[model samples]
Target: MAVSKKRDKNVYKAPRNIGKPESENPKWLIPTALTMLIVGVVWIVIYYITQANYPLPIANWNIVVGFVFLGTGMVLLTRWK
Candidate 1:
């Protein structure tokens, strides 16, 4: 007669092939994302320091532009492997 043991119902077992190779990010990914982030920060900083007079004559709209750059950079970073 063969005897078998059952697995614990509450325990979790990971698969053998769990460690897949990491995917490589595109050559432009890092630089572009970093640039966007830096540019966004600088844009906002300048806008504040200049009392909303520089970067763009649009005043409050400059904040929107800066945030857009920041958002784009963040989104790009999420795709990195």
Candidate 2:
């Protein structure tokens, strides 16, 4: 049996932005996400540690506030691509 040494010349090329540094990621994405997440957790933590003083002194409002921040962060993550 004999074999042929022919190769396919057709190749696919990806878009330019695929490897560009500018298309890596949005500048405020990570920072904003982190800020919301961290602030939410910290606020809840502080609320728990300090009953009614500093930050928000409202009763049980801290939970709602924390959740809002956390939810916003999660929403932002969805549009990362």
Candidate 3:
């Protein structure tokens, strides 16, 4: 015959955040994200249109800047809500 051990009732349990309202996003989030996406697209477009002769003295840097802006905006947007 084998004896079974009883379960412990005092085990620590994390609280469930049920019935909690969803948090609202910051007011600036949407606009800023949109602006960055737009700017990135526009920068690429302008670079192609001008044959990489406009925006900045260095042709390659323009693209880099545009991508940085886009990345930043995306990161900010993810934090929203």
- Give me the overall lDDT of model 1: 0.94
Reference-based TM-score of each model: 0.75, 0.65, 0.69
**Candidate that would win on TM-score:** 1
1-81, model 2: which lDDT tens digit per residue?
899978777767778777546555688998898899999989888887887464677778878999999999898787676
| Backbone clash pairs in model 2 (N, Cα, C under 3 Å; residues 3+ apart or in different chains), count | 0
Candidates in order have lDDT scores of 0.94, 0.82, 0.85
- Error (Å) of candidate 3 at residue 59 is 1.7
Could you say which candidate leads in lDDT?
Answer: 1
Candidate 1 lDDT over 1-81, as tens digits, reads 999998788977787767764677899999999999999999999999999999999969999999999999999999887
Task: Give the Å shift of residue 80 in candidate 1.
Answer: 0.4
* Location of the lowest summed lDDT over 10 successive residues in candidate 2: 16-25
- lDDT by residue for model 3 over 1-81, one digit each (tens)? 999999999999877876665787879889989899889888878887899987776868989988988898899888876
Candidate 1 clash pair list: none
Worst 10 residues of 3 by lDDT: 17-26
